[model samples]
Target: MKGWRARLGFLVPPGNPTVEPEMQALAPQGVSLHFTRMTASGPAGTHEGQEERNRSQIDSIESCSALLAMVSPQVIVMAHTATSYTLGSAAEAALVARIEQLSGTRFITAFGSVLAALEHLNVRRIAYATPYNEVTTLQGKRHLEEQGIEVVSYGQLANVRNIYEENDERAYAIARAVDRPDADAVFLSGVGMPTLDALQVLENDLGKPVISAASAMMWNALRVAGVQHSHSGYGRLLS
Candidate 1:
């Protein structure tokens, strides 16, 4: 670890294989990202047991917070967007406080990061796309609305089962599915639903800013790490 730059730690799901590589590609020259995996994969099992999946996510934060303390990294990154969305505002704030108190390090979550990116970009009206079910997708919309961002229109692929099987084709399809003419900016939600590779393609075709969960997470991480690199190829958040 000698002469190495600041390390950003991500608490990601064991099944998630996208965020780390996306962050690495978007990270600045001096920053390195290390991840600590949790048992969370996705919130879907049987048709009637979806609630159980949500319950499982709450268990990861404390362990992740403890794991982050071992590395003594400059920042702790929460890579799960669903956890923040599922837990709501008050709980999310408390989670951050608990992590900071436990690790004595700065922390950022995907949901919080996207909100920050929306603020930095001055995005008021937004269109959203996700691979989650209607219930979960609406929950995310409500969360953003509570933060004063207007979700004009939203689309979901409605893939409630086997979320790990989601690939680039689904992300690109959802990106197209959610693109509406009335929205000022677009938000591609769901950390497990891949979208980083198709962001530029979506933005180019849509002719507006497109913010994905992974891109916003990386932007927020770098900002928290105090890196000043002006990244290109991601979105206006990076540029």
Candidate 2:
């Protein structure tokens, strides 16, 4: 198949079962999404375990990203949102810079992409939802605040061992639960949580823009790749 627009390289955490399918579902025609997994181990939902898993990804990113560079993808997307929190915004930016320097490709993380999306939508106050432990969720909240977005309300499906196991209904419920009347947008964090299926529903119900890690990743990947296409059914960021 001819990739007339661009080829996207995605780096996802090992054992994640949702990012690939979710990204593919949001990709526009003429755009191709390729993925490689970083090394990660240990039980999920524990702070030490999550840190170890993130460390594995950080340790293995160079080699894994090098492999993706071989395809000459226009943009590289770090599909793990928690990695940004694990490394903090500054460290994560440095890590992305290093990856770009090594791979000779531009890079975007799920967290970074979501921030850009929120800015693009002019959303200052947002209600956030995530399928992470309290520690990771707090990190995400801090990262968002550093970007100048106010998190008016926040909720999490705490202690979820595998975010991919969450169904769309659960995702919708979380978004609805986290939404606040003062929020300009609803941000559903965690790329591994199935969210595309509920994006439109959430937007309609909340009467506000809805953004998810997966949706923002796809939108940012397309924009960074110079593909000026807009997709429907996801949210205003894409459409």
Candidate 3:
């Protein structure tokens, strides 16, 4: 309602608890974020049966559409990176398009944001770290490779369910473990995995750029909200 203030609505899995604060921490001035949880029946706090977990996710888009309608945000962000990364770009884009057609609003997902960020940096090589099962993690790597970015290395944490249960420590540990000397950048996938607190430190320690799903989500959302996108001490996407 205010010119300087823009509202961003995020649709996340019910099991996810990391998107909010991580995105919030990266939000630029004059932008506010809100969230809507969709059905996410899974192991609850670990990265287990991803196929079953994402099945619930596929069923939740309509609910996400409904939530988008209620929020009337300038843009809706699909806050889970795994879905987009594992589902492939076409599937992710189709979901965003479906939600946009349903709600007459635009949307972006974590994969979309990461893709955009990578393009902005002109990077064609990357390494990834994920707290997803092996199946999902490989799917993510394949998804990125399909986009023409060479996957130099990857690390999988195989965490199965909830994100709050997997906190900053896990992210930091995985980040340090996943950094590859040959990769142009390191990607910490999944907004629910909590990487904002570890991203900068990882960059400092690794001496390379790092990008997280949570950070990318905030960057893209802010651009959609018409905010001046700039930040210091983060990654190249914002800096």
Cα lDDT listed for each candidate? 0.79, 0.87, 0.78
Residues 1-239, candidate 3: write the lDDT tens digits: 66647888888877676777777777777777788887777565456666666767878877776777686788888887777765677877788788888888778887888888888778888888888777788988999888888998998774445555777778888877877888888898877677777777777888778898888878888887777768876766777
Model 1: which residue pairs collide? none
lDDT score at residue 14, model 1, on the 0-100 scale: 61
Q: TM-score: which is higher, 1 or 2?
A: 2
Provide TM-scores for the models. Answer: 0.91, 0.95, 0.91
Q: List the residue pairs that clash in candidate 2.
A: none
* Residue 182, model 1: Cα distance from true site in angstroms: 2.3
Per residue, candidate 2 scores C-alpha lDDT tens digits across 1-239 of 26367999999887788888888788888888899988887765344578778878888888989999998899999998888888987899899899999899998898899988988998899999998878889989999998899999999985565776787788999899999899999999888788998999888887899999999988998999998987888777888
lDDT of 3: 0.78
Candidate numbers sorted by lDDT from highest down: 2, 1, 3
User: Model 1: per-residue lDDT, tens digit, 42-149?
Assistant: 443322443455556567777876787687788888887877778899888998898888789898889999999998888899998887777778889999999899
Evaluate model 2: give its lDDT. Answer: 0.87
**How many residue pairs of model 1 clash at the backbone?**
0
